[model samples]
Target: MFEFCADPSTLETGPWFACYLTNGVHLLFYQSFLTVLLLLAITAPVALAFGFAGAAASRSHIAPLRWFGQVYTSMVRGVPDIVFFLFFVIALDQALEWINHQIRCPDWDEPIRQGANFTVCQAAKIPLSSSPQWVHEVYNFGVAVFTFAIVFGAFAANVLFGAMRAVPRAQLETAEAYGMTRRQSFWRVLVPQMWIYALPGLSNLWMILIKATPLLFLLGVEDIVYWARELGGSRTSQFAYPHPDWRLWYFLFLLVFYLAFTRVSEIVLARINTRLSRGQATMAGEAQRRAGA
Candidate 1:
């Protein structure tokens, strides 16, 4: 906070506004917006990769791998998202600590779970009990990212799997007739064409992913929502900055933020759809050709 903001008791509107916005916590609050964007940027590709692998495995000839992929893709739809978010963080965290406990606490033979408390040796503690604040934040962030990826990966798998199937079987047969093996045809023919079909579904998934970023709070990552709630509430005169409850204004800012981002996303996806449609056999491609002629 600025020196003028040190005592907000007598400050005029402009000075108070300046200090309130510049305060340390407010700075963190602003950065949390970037944190939301960063999570989406990092998670999208990773989840897509995971989805690709799952889709491929589901289509595999092998029984067990196919079953695993089917289960992975279906689980997201079957389980409620909020339930998954709440449960996965604790489950994943404990699972990580348990693995560490088994390796690091071999000499100590104590029940890992006693009543409601789960205990692991200090060595097994993630970010260790004595670690700095940043370590905790980083660990929490990692957990949030992993959770988001796992949940979204399943949805992506469903989209890609359908897209792969939408690729014309005749195209694959033509590749085979040219002496290409199944693997060769898949990479050279089917994979290339599936994107046209996949784009629509994946675009929808991207919108959902953007909307889902707010769930970062459920994972205990202090995200924009958390900050908005904290900063918008009434601040007593005893505090450095006294303000009436402004949650409505703060949330309105968030609403506009999402609306603008999603609007841009729609425009970008439209251009991509247009680019991908060119020369394809779809109606859109035919229209494009007619326009050019």
Candidate 2:
């Protein structure tokens, strides 16, 4: 990044460190932090949508829908996250390729599953063999997003479902007495009030999701954890910039980053909870009313 970076070996302490930090590899490391943030940004809302759908499905009048939602939440909650992460990505990828193979390779007679290997025709390959590196990375990141969403969505669904049920029965009855349809009562009366109840659970889930970003390494997204380990390992003098094993420092930075992130999240969530609590019959609202009076 600097002209003095031409010979890193010739540089003094300050310049050496500066140039080392600004190198191409270090730039990637910096970018990995953004990758983690982007994952959280994209995953949170998508997972919330999934959770809402699942929660609504569980509460549906249709027996099949309710059963499916109940089963989804129960099954996912019971399974270990690592197991689901490993299994789901492969399964979802293969399922997509398999469907694509059927559509794009109907003329081929070769079996997709021979012994243990699952193979699809070149045309049906995800991103195709000729695609750019960025396309492959994007596809992998997308798979990671969906996997995170599905797993976290189940937990969110349980939280939301409980929140929905926590809304007072009297309120719903009153809405019905006023001639509001079930759907109208739910959307207009119940949903708005449920956030105060759901906020605590969702806040904790957000923290967990933040902690789980390291799992992106397993999904091939080259996340912060991956870069930390890569850059922190000792490099010999033959490399452009030699360094001793610094993984301890690297991980310490991660620890600090997460702690700060979660601390800020707590403050933000508290404010949101306070906002949602306003004018409601909940204890927080009642306390606010007393304080104001």
**Highest lDDT model number:** 2
**Model 1 regions more than 4 Å off:** 1-3
Query: What does candidate 2's lDDT look like per residue over 266-285, in tens digits?
Result: 99999998899999999999
Per-model tally of clashing residue pairs: 0, 0
- TM-scores of all models? 0.97, 0.99
Question: At residue 293, what lDDT does model 1 achieve?
Answer: 100
Residue pairs with backbone atoms closer than 3 Å in model 2 (clashes): none
lDDT of each: 0.91, 0.94
**Cα error, candidate 2, residue 30 (Å):** 0.7
lDDT of 2: 0.94
Residue 275 in candidate 1 has what lDDT? Answer: 96
Against the correct fold, how does model 2 do in TM-score? 0.99
**lDDT by residue for model 1 (175-239), tens:** 99999999999899989888999999999999999999888989889999999999999999787
